[model samples]
Target: MKLLLYPNCSNGGVTAVIRSRANADKENTYLVVFTNDRGGRHSFDDLDNVTVRIVPDFRLGAFLTYLFNEYVFDSINVFSMPKIVEQMVQRDELAVTYEFHSSNMSIVEKEISQLPLDRVASLVVPSQEMKSKLSERLPKRLLPRLQVVPNLVDEFVFNTNGRSDRLSSLEEGLIPLVWIGRLEASKGAHFVPRVLAQLPENYVAIMIVSLESDPTRFDRFLAECDSMGVAHRCHILMDLQQQTVAEFYRSAAARGGWLISTSLMESFGYAVSEAISCGLRVAAFELPVWSRFEEEPKLVQVDAGSVVQMASAVAGKVS
Candidate 1:
């Protein structure tokens, strides 16, 4: 009944899974963080039955020490880390489950293909589209192990009462467009400038960049904004707590603004769901994964990679 949860970093979605499971089965769950990203550590601090372990270096010596001395986990749940799953498979006593969260399967395709599929208990995915994508990439023998488990957002994100104090400093009359994700090429951070350029001059993009994001790339994104003459319309925020993020969603909704997802791909749109839960409008690139939400009035889907179309959709939503 004991479970070990190993997430690559303290990502919001990954941490949500850890929190939900810990709350559900507090007595038998353990959380092991393998990176220096401490973004989601607060969520685990007060849990009575959850054991939290941190291995900052992730060096071979440190990993071996953790594996030999503290690795008595009966079952391991891995998130977005194939190498960890590979390591766990070597220990035949442990039942391993991989929770697939990324739409970009190329990164882990080789690792998954080479894995001991028979030893894996399940391959959990968040969306039917992801399940379908994995099906095409994986061997037919591994199809039976695929499980569809939707991503969970924090309950606080649904609350609409509070206002984000961080947004208070923003000038009046500007429409706030909230963007949440890493500042990476795959997530479409580089496209924001062009999208903003296409929007009304009063529109401002409030980007909540993930802690696991690359600093160099983010700086480059900002530089690109400057070059594009849209830097003034961009507001960058980072390392925010879940409750604070909810407030931002509420604030945006209250201001007649909406959330925007510029991701090239999404296995599951947690940010989009959270924005909708808070009664905010959303404009995102059309993806097969978001087909389920097509009927939702608050969601506006545009052609993928069409910056002009995305900008037009957001402008129309706010207008």
Candidate 2:
């Protein structure tokens, strides 16, 4: 079947989802539509059976309709596009599926109103925790349509290889740490500088500002770092390729660096998982979603909402 995938946002996790599906399902003709704001090296873009288009913002619903009229896909799979999904569901001619990626209550209320849950083939959530949360807000009729399907990471591309021994090459006395995420409140961005302030002087942080992060928020984060007097120790990097991310992870791991996640909520955390897979030890908040990865030995779960605990946990990782 020719399946078309539409995602409302362009973050690393969403891009990874699109690329994974196209690569895994080679027999099907896959068409992917993204807004101009979504940018990533979509590895499947060049595949003969996969057609990818980046249309302008707010034109997505109309663009998908245009593609539908052109008969570009046999069925449609969309992530978190509520109003459009409702419109598509009303159309008896189209086969559709809706994916829920957020656990935010306000967004959940919108889905409860706008998503025609009974009309679609399925309602997909990325994690069981997300499903449990949605189970409360979504209509009982929507329950039967719900399914849990995980996002994928390319094992070969993200694994611990093609990395340098950064341990010996770096300054001998310093311990490095890394943080990767959108500079947003739910990610616990404000807590980062606080955690850095509590850590010892020998420790320094490398902050990787992800795509789609708010520049204003980033400025605030820097100001927080400056106010805490740790701005000089915080290094900011941006727009790195996947290979480079993996390389950073591998090298940081070799140098005894830890991957830190201050996020208060996550549907599924891509950066933390990828860092662990690439051989980095991790110190993250004890989010309920992380129960899925309880067996990972390298992970240290700090008490959520406590900067002192996170700093203490990260410091403990060094020993």
Candidate 3:
């Protein structure tokens, strides 16, 4: 049996990634754990081979002690979790793979530097972009143990020709712009309304984001939309399955729409990759991490930090 641990609710990409992995693994019985920091839905609770548990108390001691008493795990894989190495600092022959999912390398470096290296079997990152970032910040001795493992985006085998009710408000002939991520400045969601404002009125925006992830930012994003006079044109949708989102992306692509991103940085751009997987063109800032999709003709990268450049990339020759 393997153990997968994370500190977030079913908020965003990470939870979905775990669910995909759990569903694919038929050989191993896994225990998937999460914390109720934000208190939302469970994506893995219904899986047959996976046992879903939540730790209400987030302290490292409380978390470990509670799990230790209940069941035994063969190996443990942790996602962006803190201070667990310290708890097992004195243990011998432990099997632990610490996976860093954060967009910030400084945070990853600080946490790894504090860990007792002997307790950790290996360290894994989601992409080469992240591994490169970690190599720059982490100590020279720790470099050899670091490995790059790209994240998995769920594949859709079927297409939905029917339109979802959430998207019914969008009329025909409008260029439906799509954005997906948490409502955070890091994810570049704040840039959506401003970019929408710069574009022509014929372009309407549809945002798929987690409202519970950042309520303050969610409210601020909406206010910015209202301030920019694009709130009426901005449609925000939440709590959607990947298949439904794929259908929406497919529909958007059919109407000559593009999946647009304004994220400042991405460890790996799951939204963009998933959009491309769904056969939609993707537009994002020209960040190093986006180079993974360079071969994809559908992905057009605009100059970073320029709202006008982003607007013009999606909508040709706009004044």
In each prediction, how many residue pairs overlap at the backbone (N, C-alpha, C within less than 3 A)? 0, 0, 0
lDDT of 1 at 298: 90
Predicted candidate 2 versus true structure: per-residue lDDT over 1-319, tens digit per residue: 5655555334455666666666677788776776654456354545577777777657777876777677745667887667677767767888788887664657766776877667888888888898898888777877888899887776766788777464454577677788887787888877877888998887888777776545788788888999999988888887565666778789888877889898888887878888988989888888888997878988988889888988888788432
How much is the lDDT of residue 39 in candidate 1? 68
Off by over 4 Å in 1: 24-28, 56-74, 163-165, 212-214, 317-319
Give candidate 2 regions above 4 Å deviation: 1-11, 41-49, 58-62, 72-74, 165-170, 212-214, 317-319
Worst 10 residues of 3 by lDDT: 156-165
**After superposing candidate 3, which stretches have Cα over 4 Å from the reference?**
37-40, 58-63, 66-72, 156-166, 317-319
Ranking by TM-score: 2, 3, 1
lDDT tens string, model 3, 1-319? 8888787765457787776676677688887777754433555546788877777544656767666667677888887665665675344544788888878666777777777665677888888988988888766887898999787776532233444344555676788899987787777877788888898897988888874744787788888898999999888888566656777888788778888988888888888887887677878888899887768888888887778888887886532
> What C-alpha lDDT values do all the predictions have?
0.75, 0.75, 0.76
TM-score of each candidate structure, all chains considered together: 0.87, 0.89, 0.88
**Cα TM-score of candidate 1:** 0.87
Candidate 1 per-residue lDDT, tens place, 1-319, comes to: 3555454445466675676666666557564654555566676666677766556544633574466466576666776656555566666566788877776777658657666667788998889998998898887988999989877655644566666555777778888999987777878888888889988898999988877545798789989999889998998888676677888998888788889888888888888888888888998888888887968999988888998888888778442
Model 1: weakest 10-residue lDDT segment is 1-10
